[model samples]
Target: MSEKTGQCLCGAVKLTARNVPSTFNICYCDMCKRWAGGRFMGLHVAKDDLNVTGGDSVTEAVTSDWAKRAFCNTCGSSLWYEVTDGPYVGGRSICVGLLDDTSDLTLGTEYYTDRKTRAYDFPEGRKQLTEAEVLALFAPTDAEEGEPE
Candidate 1:
């Protein structure tokens, strides 16, 4: 796909991303829900492919042993979820809602499905991964590479 542009709610932070796909993943983990107020629909992108302006306004908090969360310090709009180590190093999961245009993007997968709260449920048939399944898919691969899981 072509490059896309977007900005935070207050426009204090703007970004341009190249080579973005037409799909995004949804995370139903508790941390995701707490951070984003619901499922976090993130557009997966390579870190280098995403360029930002007003970067000084972006602040990050290490949310886990393997990744950190970034947001606009001015408006608190989520920017992206970054991997600190492992095969996915230099990769980021950009917040889909931050995109200026979202007409082309589709739901790719849902992670932490088993942990999804009872308050919300999605339609059946989408690709789904439970917490255990997600760990099994990523942990060993990164562990073998000597990166923190």
Candidate 2:
């Protein structure tokens, strides 16, 4: 139940999250890569425990039917990725790159290994899951029914 505070680039938006775990996750999906300019590193922050000041400066986009991403409108700094609907509704993963301090964060997991390109590679021995495996872990139960599961 650690507490951390961070702000977007240019300090236009300030955020605090309570009950944060010490681990961070990385996403290597194409959308994430395009969003963050490479793999996206995120710190899981519960929606209920997150507080933001200067919300007026934050703009969000619905990246997918199930998720949306928010960023600082002023500096265009990536803020967070949030579940928009389904079982993960209200959950958020904040951008770790904007953290004011991150001496405590450890690599927890990486998803979209299959999407990883030969142009870049992370260190060996990281716990990783391919795109299909990620879908199995996160796809909402409703989406699984009657779909190509």
Clashes of each: 0, 0
In model 2, residue pairs whose N, Cα or C atoms come closer than 3 Å (at least 3 residues apart or on different chains), thus clashing, are: none
lDDT of 2 by residue, 21-42 (tens): 9999999998899888889999
In model 1, where is the ten-residue run with the lowest total lDDT? 135-144
TM-score of each: 0.79, 0.79
- The alpha-carbon RMSD values of the candidates against the true structure, listed in the order shown, are 17.9, 17.5
Residue 6 displacement in candidate 1 (angstroms): 0.6
Point out where model 2 deviates above 4 Å.
Answer: 122-149
Index of the highest-lDDT prediction: 2
Model 1: per-residue Cα lDDT over 29-105, one tens digit each: 98888888888999988888999999899999999999899999989999899889788888889998899999988
RMSD of candidate 2 to the true fold? 17.5
